[model samples]
Target: MERVPLSEVVSDCVRRWFQDSLKEAKAGDVAMQVLVGQMYHSGYGVARSEQKGRAWFEKASRYRSSVWKVSNKRPGLNASDSDSDEVKENIK
Candidate 1:
């Protein structure tokens, strides 16, 4: 029997979670799109790309009324002006 490090297991789980979110986002799930945006912004399981993140954020915002307010922070990414505005609007 072999043992995997805790960090490895956690990373793999995070990766799969983000992958599932990506699929949901592609299926037009507004909340999942926002989640995918956050993942991209933070590089949780994918490479961080502010451009791609912003695009997803904007797409998700179009359905803002359908999405619930989650959090206002992206762990490893700085919030841009638009990002702040989006969060504010979503919170409202």
Candidate 2:
């Protein structure tokens, strides 16, 4: 069998969310899980697999809450000034 580079594997994985491979990754793996969901949701890297997309999206959202602390948001994480839950909650 031929071997594929790690980067290539990741690129292909990102290019498409294969159900079998998605199953191998735990829902707890937030980043990959989210990407899988995105692939389905936006048809970005995969077909418009909404069922799979929604499932993974929900999993990623919940998983994020579980692992993340309500701290200051950072720019690298794509945190915007308006993206703070605490700020939003406090405003209401």
Candidate 3:
């Protein structure tokens, strides 16, 4: 799971950020889900888990779709216009 590098150590701040983002993600925040996904995929803080990352991404996609279906407006993505593609970029 050495996605970043063997020598690169995760900082405490990054770990805290991951924890906070994970909490928000669990609370139904799509943005947080993507962020947490990125963190997991990159091993920025928590242990690397591409499977967990993809799971979070799928959750975000499903949630976003439901939100759009209900309101006729997609959730505004801050990083990019496309959520799936943007979220996918990090994993690859």
Candidate 4:
């Protein structure tokens, strides 16, 4: 999948989608957290902040570790469970 450049993702709806994903990330959705990290890293729909991106990525990694303890499988960072095409696109 081709990535949508951050400069090209200026739509309000896209921004809202990222905001919603961030909310889900805060709620312990590991995949969403990674997506949020990607967004932050690239400044796709938010201010670019490598520190915040790394933080989110670390959070997601911790969550994945917890999940692995229970399921014996890591929650891999893939777009399989994404609800938005934009997420799928950006996550790749």
In model 1, which range of ten residues has the least summed lDDT? 71-80
The per-candidate count of clashes, in order, stands at 0, 0, 0, 0
lDDT of 2 by residue, 1-92 (tens): 99989988886866545554366447456655655665565565567777876686576666465213212222113112235755778899
> Judged by TM-score, which candidate is best?
1
Residues 33-58, model 4: lDDT tens digits: 87777777777678878788778777
RMSD of 1: 6.6
| Residue 92, candidate 3: alpha-carbon lDDT | 94
Q: Scored by CA lDDT, what does every candidate get?
A: 0.71, 0.54, 0.65, 0.66
- Model 1 lDDT tens row, 1-92: 89999999999988998889899889998767878888887787888887877788788777674322332455323223346767788999
Candidate 3, 16-87: lDDT as tens digits: 888998999999988787777767766767898878877877787675643222121222232234556646
In model 4, the clashing pairs are none
Q: Which stretches of candidate 2 lie over 4 Å from their true place?
A: 1-24, 66-92
Q: TM-score each candidate.
A: 0.72, 0.44, 0.61, 0.60
Clashing pairs in 1: none
Error of 4 at 39 (Å): 0.2
